[model samples]
Target: MNAPASAIEQLQLGLPELDWITDPNRIQRLSQDFSWFSPVLTRQLEGKVADAVVRPRTEEQIRQVVAACARLKLPLTLRGSGTGNYGQTTPLAGGVVLDMTSFNELLWLRPGLARAQAGIRLNEIEKAAQAEGQELRCMPSTYRSATLGGLFGGGFGGVGSINYGPLAAPGNVVGLKAMTIEPEPQIIELRGAEAMRMHHLWGTNGLVLELEIGLAPAQPWLETLAVFDDFDAALAFADQLARAPGLDKREVAFLASPVPDYLTQLAESLPKGCHAVLSLVAEAGEEALAELVSAHGGRVSYRRTAAEVSKSHKTLMEYTWNHTTLHALRVDKSLTYLQTTFTPGEYVRQITELSRRYAGEVFMHAEFLRNMEGQTNCSALQIVRFTTEERLQQIIDEHRAYGVRINNPHTFIVEDGKAGGDLPEDVLAMKARFDPLGLLNPGKLRGWPVGAAS
Candidate 1:
């Protein structure tokens, strides 16, 4: 149970040119992520721990580590901030965890794009870009803590997805610099369609070193939390504002009754029975936002400028997205969540039916977003009242029967129920080309079953 000297010694033996960690406590912490958010994963991956952790300071050190792991056939799982909900950072094969935090650095900033090392905290990048009059296109709710590389590796989309679309959406990611696993690794700069091969691959293919991402012009935002007579109206108004022309917005989320009740920090602002629609609209568009809310039968419950919100040290975004699920879990440990996407015009109908069918079991929370084609849509991160694992799958089945897409968070395998769920040929082809040895994060990808590539 003590720190294993041999674990660190093996890494040192393999790659003597790196800083390594074998302290059992630190190794255990490095091996975990928010994957516990899913009860299924908690049960499945419980007690699974990494054997060692190797922290790389530069891209050269990463190359040396990847090459060593490939030679030793050690499953090297890449670790960013480990803010991912899936067990993307957990080493199923019990090998070396390649920690990337030390690689943090802001390399450069151009007019419409910026380049930075993989381990840089998103907030760090945002601050640098803001100083240069730009900001990240879209960021996950864990904005301040999550590294941009982790965002590309496991995240979907959040705050800025309303306008910039998902991370996989074209133009969001300009390019990525990746290093393949082999005796002598090579850093490959992937661009256009090629860069996407590594996206959401769960760091199973290669280690991302640096990324060149597209940026949006910086804007002063008004952090507004509005109240509504009904959940439906709040959602409808948010949808209207999402599509409204000339009105710029960053994040827009609709949280129903009990969901808002779970937020203790804003308990005084939100009415007891009222639903809430949280958003970060452009400061210049505040008038338009107010008009839209009034027209849709809602009133502004709380309003703060970005500067004011920052002063309070709480962001409305932290109250939306998976943050909503996290807050509820803080209050009641018995709840889990479902990641779902709904069609454009049928949100009302589908929401009504799901509410009636599951009733109090599944509570509705929708975050409005735009797809790759710039079409308006929403992904629901519904909080569920836990009964049993079988019942959870049944709820998922019911939703799928209604044509809703569920991105199963319970499973660590790359394949799921959606198009992205099934391993795409593009990624497979990329792996075949880059990771011929099959040493990087071996057990995480189902498509590349143990030694299948061999």
Candidate 2:
């Protein structure tokens, strides 16, 4: 690896037209992410940082920069909004950091689909779709700041995931345009299974330029914030509400403890020792939704009309899980999160036991995801707060020993388990075929071409 200053000078001389950042402070800021277990901190402690950072605006510029780096045998890492919880976007080889935010552009929008540049934020795309009476089928909690490319590359389940399914499903993404680094860098367009294979690989196989996604009709939605006296009741009601037929359009199933100040409002409203669940339902009338809640022993603490929701939904992004975690982190800087899947039927009991075991050391926060393959299986995202790094690792170990599968965003990439099994072989094969130089995010992917690292 080259010295940071020397590499920055070399890259500038090679690609003067591309914007380059060499400041040590800025490089330090770019080195880490929201992940609690990021290796960047340790790397920084070792006095190492990315050799250089490049921000390219155009597709040709991106290609040109990659071509140059490939020629120099320098590693490259792609970044979007940097809202990812995993270290997926962190440069491991201390090479070039490619900031893709400047590539923002909306190429096209039809009735059922829309194509956008990799840097476009999810909320930006949603606003455009709303104008056409349509909306994205699903979006992660970080939609406001998260770029489309980042979500496709690193995001897992989100609020709308309960209805439309995970983003990797064939029905969600229509196509993608990506740049490959190999014998010769070239742009290629893929659709169907070929395109879907790249989902959640953390930008290892290729660098995405544009994406086309299927859209859902924009419907009047009701947003409600509710509270319950007991955790079990809240969990039971949430499960019943989520599993009820004809309620496929619930946007979010967020449950949080009373620790955070924001949740303190719910704490004030509910009886002592109460928890809260915030639910957003779309395409349902108020009366029907009210009846469903009433049947499940849920009282609608607060309700917003469709017009209000549409006008404020974007603002609500700040109140979601991602933002909630940011708030919780203020209380405990060593906190880390986990992404796991569980059968909804068994979720309540299992989570309750886990929470009790961790006690004061960890607080459980969860989001309900859509059921897959009619198996009654559901995915839940959990964030664990710890006072010490050792405690964090211990919690992770306990979860694993209990046979709980975890996609630890604090360190490794969080991905769909089913998708992961098939990714390594396919990604390695694709890299061998297209990126034989292994110049693009070399060590990021799980099974990248062996010995291909430059």
User: After TM-score superposition, what is the CA distance of residue 365 in candidate 2 from its true location, in Å?
Assistant: 2.4
Q: TM-score per candidate, in order?
A: 0.95, 0.87
lDDT score at residue 246, model 2, on the 0-100 scale:
71
Off by over 4 Å in 1: 1-8, 14-17, 417-421, 450-454
| True lDDT of residue 19, candidate 2 | 83
- For all candidates in order, the CA lDDT equals 0.84, 0.69
State the weakest 10-residue window (summed lDDT) of model 1.
Answer: 415-424
Which structure among the candidates has the greatest TM-score?
Answer: 1
Clashes of 2: 1
Worst 10 residues of 2 by lDDT: 413-422
Over 1-454, each residue of candidate 1 has an lDDT whose tens digit, in order, gives 8875563466587676678787899999999999888899999888878788888898888877777777667777889999888888988778788889999999999988989999999999998899988998999889899998999998898889999889999888889898878888887889978898888888887678888999999998899888998767887787788788799999888787778878888898888867888999999999999999899898898999978976887778788889999999998989899999888777767776776677688888888888877888888899998989999988888888889889888887777524245577888888877788776777777766655534
- Please write out the lDDT profile of model 2 over residues 175-246, one tens digit for every residue: 999888743678989997788677877777788899999898887667776666666777767766676667
